[model samples]
Target: MNLLDPDQKHRLFWLLQAGGWAGWALSFYLGATVWGDPPDNYGFYVPIIAAVGMALTLGLRWAYRLTWDMRFVARVLPFLLGSYFAGVLWMVARTFIFFSLFPEQKAAFGIESSAEFYSYLEGAISAAWVMFGWSALYFGIKYYILLQDAKARALTAASVANEAQLKMLRYQLNPHFLFNTLNAISTLVLDKDTNLASDMINKLSRFLRHSLETDPMTQITVDQEVAALKLYLDIEQVRFGSRLEVLFSINPEVKHALVPSLILQPLVENAIKYGISQSVKGGAIGISAHKDGDDLQLIISDNGPGLDFSQGITPKGSGVGLENCRERLKALYGRSQSLKLGPTLPHGLTVTINIPFSQEA
Candidate 1:
């Protein structure tokens, strides 16, 4: 409803046009009456002149629509020339009205004499400038709205694509994790450990149920991520039992900080796979998180044989968990988030993720 808003430019344009033409009519009336140029007329013709100017400009506004296609000179040039002629026609009509009203008065700016044509043409030239300015404003507003619409559509498409990618990455974890868990359960069954296999199956069901309940694109708190990771670690604990030593040093201040749903599960799994599973003694793994300025840093490190790569890149394995996490973070936060793999202390690997700290998704 704000008249000053660019979105309401059309309404503002009409209001300004009405006011401008009204001012022009009043100026004309004052010049005619005070100077006694048109036989001392009252303000009867002022309203008519204002109405005519408004109508003439409204017509020009309609004609200006075709002038936008500047590439086709044959089409655009005619509208430009016609607009100027329309202004001349408006002046001619006003001159005739004035001459008819004051028969005995001088006709210096009227079409009564061929000599007065120059004076009429001068008024037409001034009116042409007004039409030109109106056209410029109209085109400006039209193009601005068009550009805004285009940007909105592009942003919407990008958002939908990002969401689709996040969903794909989230679902990718299910089959991979399920296959590995089922293989472990099968090994326990082959060894005639029915009680341990039953427990693993129960833990796996709970983890899968939790994953299905939570939306892939929706973000969860660090505490929720930790809870999910605990469920995953519990399943691995059943398999590794005495060997898997897990530790959590989470900051209470960052418990509610937003993180992608099930983000920590893959990182913890990766830690156990490459760290605990590879070692004979099966070293300890640490999961910690804290708020660092405007960012939240999540770390998953384990005491095991680190990567052999000199550049410290976690090479893509048969499991696409790390790659999926990286791509998901990229889609969610663009370049604002990061995932880095580096050697932890003297030995072992550490996966550190830096993401913006927020309480909401």
Candidate 2:
């Protein structure tokens, strides 16, 4: 639809030109043959006239383009008027050629004197309609193409803005994540637990390196996501010891399913922050992935006091981890993906995500 898109515009131009001109020629041929008793030579002359008109319109198409480029209104009106005047001249030339080729046909149309040539010019009024029709078509197509180009540009700008926002949200996780981990390491150092602090630091380095190497926009397999989550949990396990129990019941068939990289991390982080970390005896966190028809379903849940939505109280109070996850999912999948929060059995919080099942990242 875009005029700047050469292949689409070029194809449409040829189709309309061929169809319009061919219809004009066929209508003329039928009108003369079926409605009147004309000379047999018209069989040859009529097609020639149609060919000439089509060729002339091609030139007018170029003139229209030039007119469109003119900035001054004064120049535009004069150029268009000049093109219409040229169309009248073209009819004059066509009439002369027809009569000169078959002088015998002049008598048939009742042309007997020089003064009578003016009568032949009267038919030029009909040719004027054809010329005006070509002009209308040219302008109409150009207007439509301009609108399509504008729409395409607008969509491109919106896509760029969404990408920038997604990057900002993804990077936001880094500083927040680093602050908490470093604080834990500092606590260990203060307690004189050098060996545990050293282990946590090593695991933290590996987790940060993995996160940095992958682009925020890129997707990864569920298996890769689980491995990253385990590295993250290992660092936390050093802090919580046997208090933090991690369980994963991922379906083997769904392990290769594609998902946004680090998408599950924020969900798991939320579980730890609001569920496991708040409990005296700590809690167990469960992660699962399965294929449901054409969708990939992922769930992260914990065994801690869940939110009471019946009382209109949801534990998500501008939580950066949960909010980041939600925004990232929206950016990636628009309306096709989903994120849901609910209570788990007995008493716990659960986060569920659904995205289109695909093998490619």
Superposed model 2: Cα runs more than 4 Å off: 1-86, 292-294, 312-317
lDDT, candidate 1, 1-361, per-residue tens: 1123454767767777877777777787878767875555547766876688688777767666555555667545655786677677767776667667766554343456767756656745676665666556556666676777677778888788888888999999999898889999999999999999999999999999999999997899999999998999899999999999999999999999999999888888888888899988888999999988899999999998977657655654435888888988988999999888878888988889999999964
- Taking the tens digit of each residue's C-alpha lDDT, what string does model 2 give over 231-278? 899999998998899999999999888998888888888788888999
Q: Candidate 1, which segments miss by more than 4 Å at Cα?
A: 1-50, 61-75, 97-118, 309-319
TM-score of each: 0.82, 0.83
User: Which is the leading candidate under lDDT?
Assistant: 2
lDDT of each: 0.81, 0.84
Indicate the TM-score of model 1. Answer: 0.82
By summed lDDT, the worst window of 10 consecutive residues in model 2 runs over 74-83
How far off is model 2, as Cα RMSD? 3.7
